[model samples]
Target: MSLVSLILALLVEQARPLPYRRVVFEPLSRLADTLDGMFNAGERGQGVLAWVLGVGGLVLAAGGVFAALSALNPLLAVAWNVLVLYLTMGFRQFSHYYTDIQLALRMDDLPRARQLLAEWRGRPSDGLSSSDVARLSIEAALVGSHRHVFGVLLWFVLLPGPCGAVLYRAAAVFAEHWSRRSEDPAFGDFGGFAKQAFAVIDWLPLRATAAAFAVVGDFEDAVYCWRTQAAQWPDDGLGIVLASGAGALGVRLGMPVVEGGEVADRAELGTGDEADVDFMQSAVGLVWRAIVLWLLLLLLLGLASLVGG
Candidate 1:
């Protein structure tokens, strides 16, 4: 049922992508803000309480619905899973930006590519060269794939019903909203728990994503980069994904780049040719292969369980 739900959801999403911001993000962002306004007191405990109320509350509701549907009819539970997965996981959520940027670059339209990249990442791409645009787009695509697809799929498989999917997505959104406000005087330690809690939740799934990339890509190079370069980046989890992805693609990433009229220093990851439009296309292939690998594994697991039963 899990495998079936996943496949159906992916197909449905490919056929008709959701308006993600309107459907999921806006409501969730409002909820996070409401929780912060109501519960935030610039204390760790308050942060924890808000996180529980936001993320845990959503997870409980999803699980409860799934349980009720499952008790009434298993098909209803499967439909619910498909609907949740449609809302939560899909390449179309981020791939349109990537596709447009790739097409812009292919046409030698650097300015358009830069604008697309900036809009997608919410960061300035003012001074980036073609190579820089390709590098950043590939990097963003890799991380986005992990976060939006692989991470959600892993959690959905780990927990019953759609609870894991809700858990991963809610935690990620809360972390983004709450964790980065540490420098705000009014926020103080209220975001501390969100950061720490997401770190714990993301650990295993991050590695699993890296490992899948390794298996599907240049295995030796991916493993080598994962060992030697992953820790070099400031965010270790992101580094793991980027290093492994760069290695698999045999493209260089994470070097210093000019952004906003300044040189933004960055650690180098992978050991191969400089990133280009070719490598960006390669990245799409890599992500698809990884997804295929995951589906195969799920299919095998389902077959084994049937045999045992």
Candidate 2:
């Protein structure tokens, strides 16, 4: 089911991609905001309560959709899952900006790249170097990959199904969306909570991503780098992925962000060869390896279940 949905969704997304600013994303964005407004109360216990209520609503919504499909025709569940994941999954959601920034850097269009990187990241990039441009790009991609793909995949596998992925991804988007708007007093405190939640939600996938980096890159170095250097980042998993990637691509990935500048890693990341398709190649390879590893494991697990049964 997982493999089928992922493949179908990815194919559907590629063949007829939806625009990011489309009306579809707007509702999801609104849904997230509404949930946050209802739940995040600046108290730990209340926050948990909020999460419970918020997640409950989300789950109920998914169940309603699933039940409706099941009633109409069980086969329709596939279409439902496909549609849900089509909107929820895919590199296209965040990678377009990644690709654009990379292209801007490649063409030495630093101003355009800076403009773009700033908008995508909600930070100033006016003084970015090729490497700063590259580092932040990689950092964003690393985190985005987890939220957009791995985290979603994990939730889908762990919960009732892809609905879990939708829930988790929604949570992630809420965190990011809220944190970015911290200047508003109403949202200021939400950043801490959102960032914290995103970190906890992302922990498992980050490690998995690091392991994938090791498998596809300079195996020993990537592993060693991930183990040692990754812990240095503000985001534990972010640290590992970037560190392993730095070792793998031989391109330095970040300086520490301004002390306490958010969960972001880079105060003054070191410079290196410009980030390029090769880096994207390595990232793509790592992602595919993770997917293959997971699919094979699920297949074997299914086979074993059949044998045991």
Candidate 3:
């Protein structure tokens, strides 16, 4: 059931991608803001409570629906699972931007590439070079693939019904809304728990993603970068992913970039040549290979369970 649901969701997503921001992100963002407004008191406890209510409530609701559907009809439950997975996880959620940026760079249209990348990142990209554009796009692609697809799939497989899928996505949304505001006094400890909570939730999945990238790409350099260079980046979890992916692709990433007329110093990852259009294509292939590896594992697991039964 899990295997079939995931495959169908992927196919449907490829055929017709959802308008993610309008459909999924906006509603979830509103929910997170509402929860924070009602529950936040600039305290860690309040933040924890808000996160629980926001994230846990969604998880419970998804699980309840799945349970009810299963009781009524097994096919209904599968359909429900497919619906939730479609909303929560898919490559198309981020791939269009990546593809457009790749095309822009391929045509030597630096401005268009920067525009696409800026839109994708939701930030200014006025000063980035061609290499900078390619590098950042690859990084975003790697992380987005994990967050949108691999993490959701892993959790969905680990838990009953679609509960885990909802849990992972909801938790991630809350973290994005609250966690990054830790420095603001008004949002103080209200975001601390969210940051930590996501860290805890993402710990295993992060490493699992890194390992899969390594297995599907260059094994030795990926492992080496993961072990030696991952810690140097500001966000340790993302560092692990970028490091491993860069190493796997044998391309350098994360160096000083000219942003807002100032150089943003960043620790470099990977051990080989600098990132370019070619490596950007390589990154896409690496991500697809990782996805295939994950599906193969799920297929094997389903087969094993059937044989055991």
Candidate with the greatest TM-score versus the true structure: 1
lDDT of 3 by residue, 1-309 (tens): 998999999999999998888888889989989988998889989988988888999999999999999999999999999999999999797899999999999999999999999889987899888999999999999999989998898899999999989988888888887766777888878878877888888888899999999999999999999999999998747999999999999999988887767788999999999889899999989998998898999999989999999
For TM-score, candidate 2 versus 3, the one ahead is: 3
Model 2 C-alpha lDDT per residue in residues 1-309, reported as the tens digit of each score: 656776787788778766655644567567657766776565445555555565567767886887788789866877778887777766676677878887887788888887888888878776566656666777787666666666677677777645777677666766666666767665446456555776787777777766765666667777666766666676535776677666655556666443223444453221346565456555566666766776677678778878999
- RMSD (CA, Å), candidate 3 to true, equals 1.2
Taken over the whole model, the C-alpha lDDT of each candidate is 0.93, 0.67, 0.91
Candidate numbers sorted by lDDT from highest down? 1, 3, 2
For residues 1-309, could you state the per-residue lDDT of candidate 1 as single tens digits?
999999999999999988888898888888999999998888999999999989999999999999999999999999999999998898798899999999999999999999999999888999789999999999999998998899999999999999999999999888887766789999989988888888898899899999999999999999999999999988738999999999999999999998888888999999899999999999999999999999999999999999999
Give each model's clash number: 0, 11, 0
Query: What is residue 93's positional error in candidate 2, in angstroms?
Result: 2.2
Misplaced by over 4 Å in model 3 are: none
Q: What RMSD does model 1 have?
A: 0.9
Better of 1 and 3 by TM-score: 1
Give the Å error, residue 50, model 1: 1.2
Better of 1 and 3 by lDDT: 1
Total backbone collisions, model 2: 11
Give the TM-score of each candidate: 0.98, 0.80, 0.97
